[model samples]
Target chain A: MPRSIPDQSKFAPGLTLQLDADQLHAFFPLLQKGVAVPATVGCTLKCLLCDQFSIPADYVTDRITTIFMDNRPVDDLEHTIIQDGSRVTLSAAMPGLVGATMRRGGFYAALRQGISHVSGGAAAADQHGTVRIKLFNLLLAELGPLVLARGLILEPAELADLLKSIPDRPLDSSPGTSRVLLTVRFNE
Target chain B: MDKIARIDMGAAGGPKVTVGDLGEYAGLGGRAMTSLVVAAEVHPLAHPLGAENKLVISPGMLSGTTGSMTGRLSVGCKSPLTGTIKESNAGGQAAQVLARLGYAAVILEGKPEGDDLYKIVINKDGIQVIVDNSLKLMDNYPLVAKLRQEYGDKAAYMSIGSAGERKLLAASIACTDPELRPTRHCGRGGVGAVMGAKRVKAIILDDAGMKMRPPKDPDAYRDANRKFVEGLRKHPVTGEGLPAYGTNVLTNVLNEAGGYPTNNFKSGQFADSAKLSGETQAALEISRGGSATHGCHRGCVIQCSGIYNDKDGNYVTKQPEYETVWSHGGHCGISNLDTVAKLDYIDDNIGVDTIEMGVTIGVAMDAGLAEFGDDAAAIRLMEEVAKGTPLGRVLGSGAAITGKVFGVERVPVVKDQALPAYDPRAIQGIGVTYATTTQGADHTAGYAIATNILKVGGDVDPLKTEGQIELSRNLQIATAAIDSTGMCLFIAFAIMDQPETFQALLDMLGSFHGITMTGDDVVALGKKVLSAERDFNARAGFTKHHDRLPRFFYNEPIAPHNQTFLMKDEELDEVFNW
Candidate 1:
């Protein structure tokens, strides 16, 4: 057996995976626009926020207006790190004063001078892990379908946990009742 | 062509009513009309709750027309809470009905000599002011319910509840929505207290046998309206996102941006945020046999409001907006959506500003009156307001007063009004707005959130101070003009992004009045409105210092990002210089 899906060894005391940025985005195109992909893509991982993905240069130059990692908006993309079980979001230019204030490396970053995220906590050197991504507004429509169809990887336990949160009555035959459709294609 | 109706409650031998020409106020409507009247007539230094402070209720310029999203009503008076000129607005049937009844503004002047509550009924015929002490101290829901029986379901109502009756600073005036439920409110700066001072229990607008106000050129008006609706329908924010999840959709987006203002502005993130998010709430609402999308008013195209039913499939309240969710949910460290919904119902029914009440409760929690994340304790505090207990009265005085009473120093307010959901430290452009808006700490006053978060019109770096002052100034001016038109402010999303849609608005105005109006004219109108309001606030003893965020916003750094309000006082002073 392929170490029983979740594979206890995969989450053992000392395991690290240098998650490739291209492989991450290729497997989950929804990550391009930004969506909280759950932590099913296993292994305790560490990667620089800028190195986690290879987006079009234009995305950095003009397309992406804001970037948020682990709920806090990333003001400095290069210095910021994406740790295990983190949520990374990407967005095009958003309107309003707050939108500008949250834009990465934008002119108004001084307004939120006290609250801009600092790169203090590094990713755990060796541990088991999971991460989530969430896309919003325009990005949702721009990149949602592919993620739903191809589906990002999730640890079996995390998948089961998410499933339990859904009300039991709607889990039967009609997938339409659920906002997110999860299909179990294979079992270890 | 609309007439002004003035009611003098202080008149000897009962109340006296007079109908007159608009005269100098002829061209103004909505916030423009109300702000002008209050600024020109009322003494700036007069006690806001005294007879000297006049209350002006007016419909926007396009209120009765067939234009979509153009039925906002402006309620203006010197605010007892902020001690500044205040023009609070809301959407309901009242504006449309009152406008069609041929009234430009209804001025409630003077104060009632005795303690008797009065009711004013308006229809196609005329206006009637009558004494009805029976309606005294009744909450908005039951009071409107009683009126529905007498006035029938078609009439719209504006009323106050125990909070207003008690003259609390946080009191809000409730306006009945399409379902005749008193859910929509003019909830800011204690305008309801001014109405209470007038001893007016409710204002019923029948408008039966009246027709919609016809435009000067019907064909042109129809064309402009069609284009306006088209722009609204195609915009992602207005059409799809708002309709699908309502304004609460910002819950997840703002949370993800790390500016959600959880636990009384201590941090920008909430651990249990997903529980109260728009996504979760919408799903739950649908599963519980309620709609995930609905409109508060008939002509609303955005449909950002909805009916939230409890698990048993009974209506609790209209879908709580994002601010209400953050205020009652994350601000107080409570994440139970059902609890937040119930709190919303209580706030609406008792006629209190939900934002003020939520922030006050958070301040109380900081004082150890109740533990953070304690839902039952929050409910008890709301019940206290409903019951008009001593503790409730202090709480109902709003967040600033609550902070004083409880000795909690970290109060988030500007000019005495509590800040809305967005933290100024996290979003600096809004910080500039909060510090400078004439109406105090109001989000909708400028709504830089459009550019900062939604990317509707354009993008601004939300975290930086660069371009923030200009952004706030331009938005404030545009917003003042929009408020005067009586159009829903949400239309800004489409109009700001699409120049043609903006032109369509000007065309609608031109077609309605049989005159051409340019972009300059719109800017001029906005400037005119702001000048009137600024003049009033100045006369009311508000100086440049009054236009600033709480000092704690500068000293205390919120967690996660650890930011403080960095906008200088001098930069904020420049917001209204134009």
Candidate 2:
């Protein structure tokens, strides 16, 4: 049986911020730089994105045109498994030769045959672990709000600059914590 | 689009202008018109800056029509930089304006005596040649501003800056965008030097009263155009990715793929690439009161261009492109967007090719003239080019000369022209293109193909890597065909993926020209253009041996991939076989 991801907020002391739509969009830099999210490792990329992250499979198929796992271009989402400490980057279809070359199962995939992701089989058992997720370009606008609402973990240093900009916002994280669980609520 | 204008700068008692019908070259446009004219008229062995060499300026076949994305203008000549037949095109109002002025092409021949500068003005009435000595040595920004005072905002302008006046080998000819800013450039092969050698500083085109070129079947043309636009809008790359962040969006993806050359091609990845990524650049532009989506011309729907502003919300320059960002940012080990934007402005102001200038600076850094990440030093070097200093002259001659003078062994160039941002070692496919393209190391040389029409990769085995040769050949041929249409190459992304889009393009062309155009016709046109270019190069003493990357690319391995260019010279020679 697969293990479920824990409710990080229940045990881990963190901060909850209420922001307007603009501030939520401004928070996308954290995603571009990268943020950590806990998930069940050893699952297929489709399961990891759809089952765990709650991103609809149709949206994943349609919107996510480019994907890179640990800097290797990912072609087959079903066979490529998610491992612990994997750094995943998602983007919409990019322009130019290199952009086309990086698309998921694109015709130009032969152009970048050296760095393509050859799937290693899924792990013997599923285990809870952390993976870094990065969103770029159009994906930032599409998936950013959902990922922020679900929650993410950020380094204290990474949040320093953003925290300074939004001083009046509420903070509940303990001082000197190494990492903070951040959840954003958009005011309707 | 019916007649050709010939101006002889060497004619006795000042310059002479003659208008003639396109007798031998009747139905050609864009690259086809330019390449065919240069191949037929100019002597291959003649000095690039001499009287026997001619510069042909032409608009693409669909340029002045109501067709979408047809604003490309081609300028061809014997290259002063590469010593090869060259055709460099750019997007601006020049093509549409020139086409509406009823000129298929403008041929500039013979070199002027003495150092007198001249400007050519054309409107609905006629063409005029006036000696404009005051315009000498002015940069593109101020030169366009000054010209706008008299010509007003209703005309499209083409001019050269100090770099061209000095005949620097990396000089480019600037074309005015819709905003009348001289930001779009026909950059590469030192076409501006050929213009400067003719002593023509600028050309002004006014189509104030001229009507758009009429199509043979207006209803069919309009229907095809609507479907073509829908295809472009529906595609993810053309609709979302490009318009959102522009071409700089490629920086992150290329870096992730370990193909973004850094520190003079020593490595494939840069540590600070995130700082210069398109996401950050677009957000910064928005935060600073500038736009992240803009067009270079009136009919450009892709809107891959943008405006760059300083931290204080003041206009700095147009958004630096992916090549500009890579060449100046990671290639030289500098990672700041502001610095890259500043270098872009200076390069445009001096009317030099950004790819050539940035690569030259990187080679200079490798030669120990300055530290790799020294942003201030890079700006100073560009300023030197503007001032025409001795060191600047050497640098302005391009990477090949810069490497020779500095004794650097690993200069990244082919056929005496600097390579663009993509490192061929990591991406072996582009390496084949860089090695075999007639235009010398240009990335766009094999781009904009309708792959469905060409049936690319169908015959070649997917397991064998030699499929790249077939892919490159078909792309280059189809690219030549598309370049003749004056269509923006971005449309290729939509057309390559959607068959309906490709059919729509054919329908648009067929209806406009009153012919039943097909895929075979496109392929034939592309082959004709490339054959003329190759024939001219062969006559100029180039052999199959010239179709190769620099020796260092094959000898030295780059990091991340730890791969060298694996394609053999024999395999590269197969690219032009078709």
Deviation (Å) of B559 in candidate 2? 2.4
Clash pairs of candidate 2? none
lDDT of 2 by residue, A1-188 (tens): 33256358432557677887777666766777778877778788888888888888888988898999988889889999898899899988888776777789876666676777898786547776778998988888788887787677767776676676664566653334567777777887
State the lDDT of candidate 2 residue by residue for B1-578, as single tens digits: 99999999999998999999999999999999999999998899989999999999999999999999999999999999999999999998999999999899999999889999999999998899999999999999999999999999999999999999999999999999999999999999999999999999999999989999999999999999999999999999899888989999888888877889999999999988888988889889988999899999998899998999999999999989999999989999999999999999999999999999999999999999999999999999988899999999999989999999999998999898998988888778888888888888899998846664567435544335777787788878889999999999889899988899999999999999999999888988989999999999999999999899988898988888788888888889998887
Query: Which segments of candidate 1 are over 4 A away from where they belong?
Result: A1-67, A70-86, A90-131, A136-145, A148-157, A165-188, B448-466
lDDT of 1 at A83: 59
Q: Count clashing residue pairs in model 2.
A: 0
- What DockQ does model 1 achieve? 0.24
For residue B72, model 2's alpha carbon misses the true position, in angstroms, by 0.6
The window of 10 residues in a row where model 2 chain B has the poorest summed lDDT is B455-464
Q: Give the Å shift of residue B123 in candidate 2.
A: 1.5
* Highest TM-score scorer: 2
Q: What TM-score does candidate 2 get on C-alpha atoms?
A: 0.97
